[model samples]
Target: MAKTACDHDVLIVGAGISGIGMAAHLEMMCPGRDYAILEARENLGGTWDLFRYPGIRSDSDMHTLGFVFEPWRHEKSIADGPSILEYLNRIVDERGIRQKISLGTKVVSANWHSDRACWELVVDKGGSRQTITANWLYLGTGYYDYDDPYDAGFDFSAFQGQVVHPQFWPDDLDYTGKNVVVVGSGATAVTLVPSMADKAASVTMLQRTPTWMFSRPAKDALANFLRRILPEETAYKITRWKNVFMQDKSFKTARNKPEKVKQFLHKKIQKALGDHYDPASFTPPYDPWDQRLCLVPDNDLFEAMKRGKAQVVTAHIDSFDATGVKLKDGRHLPADIIVTATGLRLAVAGKITVSQDGTPVDFAQRFYYKGCMFSNLPNLAVVFGYLNASWTLRADINSEYVCKVLNHMDAVGANVAMPYLADDHGLEEEDLFDFSSGYIQRGKHLMPKSATTLPWRLNQDYRVDKKALAEAPIDDGIMRFDHVDQRTQQQLEAAE
Candidate 1:
């Protein structure tokens, strides 16, 4: 298990924010490590490149969403898709990470050889199968299934109108001057309704249940003021911390004082919608932050409703007629186009088949270790973002933590590092994600198990994780590190 036996020191899947961020961290932390990024799509930006639906923008502020290494100079903190893509592109180009990216290369399966202490990846490139080996496998592939979104089981067979899913939005589809009906009440639906309202003859957001919505200006005034007064990186750091603090406080308040938070949110929405605000359509069955709240920048959605361009209907779908949707309440809504803003289908490890030796690894059975690695898994890390805050917040910490682990292995002259758990560890299993969102609930079985204790659970709190992941000692009692020669000698002795 020599280092020369592997093609590269690291193989990063998906050339999106997470992959690019990991590469940047490696360049800064582990200078000489050889790494390659494999992206299935031809483009580099993962989510930004995949989604082309109109009015697509970041629900979170850019200061927190953008990488800590890079400063977001854009005027709008809540930027659109193209702007975000530009920011990512700048990062890769400036960091010299662009050259290491392999476009149109898909990693189909990864098998870890314990004896060799490396990962053998079978990939599909240009419809041809090829094998690549690496010492470490870092999956930056997002949680959602790229090939398919969550199916709401809508029957549109008899509908003559065009139906489209936001995941695979057609570039040529036009809904101008046509009645459009968007299904679901999550972020996607909330974003689509007002975006389509400008040109559509009528835009209706059809939801089975309402989602909590909050409105704010897209541009951050304080951030802009600070940027003018201070250096770019300095301002970015300050703004980043400020937003992070506010986000944590808001989330905690929502959890601790749901009723008070709900009233505050209701008041905000009422101010925006005014005469158009209806409790039935605006109020969700759950409390704030129970599911991620929908962000409406500058009250755009409410403005559209006030202008009579967009409307919200709280009802269940009965079926689809030739012209439109029929409500379960015996009401018919006419539409020429139906956009299924339905949620995403969650997938673990980018749907890649992961195995140890020749046996497949079921993530659901393994305990999550430090929100990055899994128990009993060696030299592998996956980035899953925070549910309550900006995704990059988690990605940044995870990338830095993985770099620390790699450096620790080098310092100790260990070829393999794994979090080892005994068969009867007596750890109680808890839900990995605490969200009641449909996507989380539906995909719980595919996710790794979480324990009640630290280092064994996938923590959602950024403040807690930042301190633990950054400053914690690498050689904890649970993590086993072994040199190749030592491992071989142990194997020989065991065989004897």
Candidate 2:
């Protein structure tokens, strides 16, 4: 077999927020380091480019959603998908990151070549396979498999009508005047169902469990005020902090007193929809934030139902029929198009194959070092977004910390960077996340601690992570390094 070529200081996987943010920092702070962003799709924006369903928007505002250096200046707090995509593309163009990205290149697997003291990455771009090596691996794959959405689309196929997974929405599929049935109760489901209701003949939303739905005007008025006067970055700061506090306060209420959060949300619902809204039907049986809270656009969904445009059907879908869904309650709801707004497919370490030398690390037995780094893995870090806040907030801080560690490495003339190893499960006491979503459930054991109440714990609070990451030492207890020769044994063994 031909030997794989090994070169470069850093190799980043996936050109999403984390990848882009980390790349920006690495090039700026770690001068002379060679890095490349490899992407599977022939586009820059990962999630935005992948999902094109109607009414798609960021679940959180763009202020915190944007990179720290490049703040989003849009008037609206919560930006739609197109605008978000445009913003990312603008950055890629302005920074000339487009060329640094190997478009259409998908990372199949990355193996630690102990002999080289770096990682050997295999990628498939188009039909050609390429091998590249780097001293450090930054994974920003965003913990999702876009293809899996439709892989679970078989139940949806039972319907005689059109079936589409929001992630893989067919450009040719049309929903005009056709009755639609949307499944799932998360952000994707709510956003797609009501927006389609505007044009479809009718819409029926099926849910396995209920989610706390909060109503907010898509465009926040105060943000509009900030946009007119302050600089875009300043406006972004204002809006970002505003959302940080708002979401924090809102989520705190739910975690503290479920009844109070429900009451507050119900009051808003009553005021927004008035007679058209019925709390009895809309109110979720479980507490708010049990999973992820559902965000609605100015009660636009409720208005659709009030205007005789749609209806919400709460039931467990046992299967699908030729023209409708068969509920566990023994009732059939008809439709012309079926969209499974299901949850995501969970992945750890952005699906990078972590190994000791060439031996695959068993994720089932492994523990998270922090939310960002993995145990037993050296010279590697994964950037994961906040399930609670706009992803960019966490990503910005994560990249900053990563750069800080890299800087420390350069100062010490170190060859490897790794998580601060810890003994025991080392997991925090209270649950960081209790989302009942399947993805969360599947990988809950391997995830890092939430430590929402502690400083060491990743709070997803930008203020907190910013300070914590700022203090991490390259040789902190979680990490250790040796001179080049010391790493050669592992590298040579893997090569053999």
How big is the positional error of residue 484 in model 2, measured in Å on the Cα after superposition?
Answer: 1.0
After best superposition, candidate 1 residue 221: deviation in angstroms? Answer: 0.6
TM-score of each: 0.97, 0.90
Error of 1 at 181 (Å): 0.2
Q: Which ten residues in a row have the lowest lDDT in candidate 1?
A: 482-491
As a whole number from 0 to 100, the lDDT of residue 172 in candidate 1 is 94
Error of 1 at 493 (Å): 19
Displacement of the residue 251 alpha carbon in candidate 1, Å: 0.7
Clashing residue pairs in candidate 2, if any?
Answer: 114-490, 114-491, 115-491, 115-492, 160-322, 379-417, 419-478, 420-478, 420-479, 421-478
Task: Please give, for residues 386-418, the per-residue lDDT of candidate 1 as tens digits.
Answer: 999999998899999888888888887887889
Question: CA RMSD for every model?
Answer: 2.5, 3.8
Error of 1 at 190 (Å): 0.9
